[model samples]
Target: MPSEPAIASAPHLNIVPASVTPLPDAKPRRALKVCLLGYRSAPYGGGQGIYLKYLSKALVEAGHQVDVISGQPYPHLDPRVNLIKMPGMNLFETGLTSIRPHHLTSLTNIYEWMGKLTGAFSEPYCFGRRVLKYLKKHGRHYDIIHDNQCLSYGMLDIQKQGFPLVTTIHHPITSDLKIALSAAKSWTERLLIRRWHSFLIMQRKVARELHHVVTVSERSRMDIADAFDIQPAGISVVLNGIDTYEFRPLPNVIKNPNRVMAAVSSDQPLKGMRYLLEAVAAVVPKYPDLELLLVGTPKEDGESGKLIRELGLAKHIRAVSGISTEDLVRYYNEASVVVVPSIYEGFGLPAGEAMACGTALISTDGGALPEVVGDAAIQVPIRNSKAIAEVLETLLASPAWRDELAAAGRKRIEELFCWTRAAQQMTDYYWQVIQRENG
Candidate 1:
């Protein structure tokens, strides 16, 4: 292998207040040159992709030059921001058969292939190696670099190169590992789960060494500190924002009085889909016509599928995936109630989106959920199907109560969360990091 490239020193730039310039008398903040990094940012992949998409657009709107450097399934960004594609093996999309003789020449490719073969996730680590190589050659172009939860060792290298780096740790992957282990059926399953999460070792080390670590919520700040053994005070909090304009209610969409809706990304153990299915089954005894419209698909042989068969909920559930944003908003508008049954969430995007769509919500008081929903939605205990069922019954029976909750939810989201506000807060933090690095 060739030698590592020399680290570039920080560039000189005037750091001042953010573009919004909240104060009338405040001086004009210079348009910052920003570089955002994401290891795998597909819009439908997860929250990280959504975060990258909206944040970059918002920052550009705030009068800054933003570039997104991502690997595999690059993000959908605004026209103004540049997208620097850094493709990887993408073994998830293209099976192991995609590897060829030419792939063996690159050590990063070999590492990624081997890790995937062994049931380990190697995207973050391989992405780090690629990113380090890219930035080492052109690191001086940006005033600051913000990473979206790809806590790889290469990030530490980037920081060592004298660049001002900030990382957003949405939540600790340790939380997911714990939930998966508890739900495992056998020792072999437990072992496989641990192997898949082996990259956490790199993440924990990098997180501890980084100077500026931020999280989306106070719960995540505390959890990340505990999971990585860092001090809570050292971690900063910046709540995520909802795209209120895109997710708002459409009055023309006719509501289905007997239907409820949820958006689950996958049939993962941590998503708590089984609990929601159980709740739906329990409620079916009362309302025979009750139906659930799930926005994401679940594997036919997965736990959720098996539970649906055992509980006789096959007829009551319908799932649709890969739908456009317009279709998603329309579904949200047509449902009588939206439920977020996550066992845990760093920041509950579904809950916020549901509320923003002017729909009544029922969510478990899992990590940071209450912080997002506040008094607007009905809060239930985690892993309790009976509680969820009782709440559903009460809400479905009372149209007046449902209308009241819906109004409150929309008001709360309008007052507290939005992409514009998130971008402004992030811009201020960027200036803070740059000034500290220069000093």
Candidate 2:
């Protein structure tokens, strides 16, 4: 392992003034009234949900009036943050293809059902409509509306109404579409994949037209520019943060020498769990005691579960889903190393969280993993089970190297990736956007 390098501050866009600009000699008022919008917010499962939960909490802690308007699987927010629930048909709930008659009672439900049947993702659009309807009927109580990747036609209406609308494109959804298309074995499969990603066309238009766009990483910023045909300068990077207090190392937790843990969401193919399973199988023969623990459930009849069974890894694999945060931290502490083998990531939160927990990381050089891990963790190429197996073998054989990497990973997170710092940076960005709009 190498000596820990200094944590570098993320590069900011030149469009905004530096942090030292002079302002009116007035005491800072109550935090800005911010409305964060998300189509879905499942706190434990997806990145968007996690972003809504933590960012809202951070903003509230900074004295901001924060409201999260979201669809199904509402975010677990800090009690202080207001939540305005926006209901959608949620047709995908039971994994059925088309929306049944039961899904349509109201006009909104009918729209959602019909849209889903026609191969369109309707949640973002419907959620936006619900949001606009709510604001119109109830009252527009928010200063600015911050959308969490729900770029829809209704958002343009909100912008036209002169609301300061800023949308965060975590990364271009085009990447996922491209990956899926390339992996498709037949023309029919490719067509279906493209249909699934048809929403990106709308996202691209909305993202490019929106005045203030925020994203999690520079890699995502650049990719969004390329995918959406917007100038890179049009987007701002407000890096996500880790709650160090919650994710810190638990030395009291027992460390299992042969255990490896990974945090994965089952739906997305870009997560690379299938490849990791292959890597696990390749290495398992050499070390009979080796085992893999997942912080999430394997998708039923999905590629991940099928691959695990195909590789004969059922006996050595344990996936613990829906566990509490405390339990997750305990698992993080118990593991010898945490692996993030994603094919692409807007910002790899799991990598940062594992690092915060003082665990050695084996992350692929996927989208922003390199940026997040720096030199603190071992890096490998994506989708290469052989390479992953080799790295896992090396780490397993070298405890001293693992300890050094773990210490470096923790130090890197403490210095640069804490939520307090992220919140302050985001506060500045929000202030700049509002100032520019109001000016």
Candidate 3:
């Protein structure tokens, strides 16, 4: 095996221009080859995968070539976009004990095994190693690499090698760690949670040293600076966009009067699904026929599942997962109102998607939710089940109010949260970084 690459000195990014302005939308200013890096991506990988898919598609439509290099659970990408597969142990998919002697033939595999054995996640680090190897050979072929929150040492090494690198920190992981700690039932459990999130240490180290960084929202930009100890001035904010065409109001599908909906990712406390469940329980007595459509699966015997059983609301809530995007829009259109009970969010994609689908929303003023929802949706305080129930009753009783909110939400998404606009802004920012680096 080769010796580790030296920790390279941080490169300075020349961002501010003196006296040059382009006439509105002048060709590019320029378009260059872009490589997007992700440790994991969708069908099942969640927001990061969705981000990779849409951003690449949008950038390609803008006339730039985009290549996505990703590890396990590879994303479903646009046909126009190129994909380079980087395989890791993906031990999370194949159980850690499944590693064979053949797997330990390489140092990368060895590192992955050791990390997994010790109860740590090694995907980011392993993927970075593979990506660095690829770039060292093909580094000059691309103009820039846009990383989707894979803040590993290899990214820093690539930057030092004079490759123009830009990273997106969706939100600080510290917020997640803090929230999980508060929910832990014991010291041992808290320690285990900390172990799982220990990757943030590497993330923090890489964040401050990177020359250019982008975040999806103003709130995320501020939070990243504080979490990673970097200057906020160095980060640019680009709002994420919804696919308005896909998530449009289904005029033909009749809405459910006694149904409420939320898209949950896990049983984790951060999503605030527990609070939403509690609120459903609070309102069900008033509307005996009410149903909560949860568009996500809970772990078998997981806390979310356990909570539902304990509350005796198992029959009232339906947990569905693995639905297609086309089907998701249908779920949004049918619900009486969508609820975003999350304690926090980086940009609130679910809320944005729901609003795009013309569903009335009741969202807590969690991080960036207020920014994403604006006055277009109903706002409430976080963790207040009574308030949620009250709003639910009001929305269900008054169809006019629901229609009014639905119209405002649809309009807001069209104006503020469309993918084409987001792609355009991102393209401009990409050019800025490329030109600055070349200069």
> Which digits, one per residue and each the tens of the lDDT, describe model 2 over residues 54-131?
889888888888989889878888999999888787777744465566766678777777777778777787887888
Better model by lDDT: candidate 1 vs candidate 2: 1
Which of the two candidates, 1 or 3, achieves a greater lDDT against the reference? 1
User: Candidate 1 overall Cα lDDT vs. reference?
Assistant: 0.86
**Model 3: lowest-lDDT 10 consecutive positions:** 1-10
Task: Report how far off residue 398 is in candidate 2 (Å).
Answer: 1.5
RMSD in Å for model 2: 2.7
Residue 275 CA error for candidate 3 (Å)? 0.5
Quote model 3's TM-score: 0.93
User: How accurate locally, in lDDT, is each candidate?
Assistant: 0.86, 0.82, 0.84
Error of 1 at 84 (Å): 1.0
Model 2 CA deviation exceeding 4 Å by range? 1-28, 94-105
lDDT (10s digit) by residue, model 1, range 1-439: 1111111111221212223364432222798999999999977778898899888998999899999999988888889999999999999889899989999799999999999999999999999999999999977889999999999999999999998999999999999999999999999999999999999999999999999988887788889989999998788766688888888989788778999999886578788888899999999999999999998887788888888889998899999987777788899989999999998999988899898898889999998888888888999999999999999999999889888888888887776777887777777778778877988
Alpha-carbon lDDT of model 3: 0.84
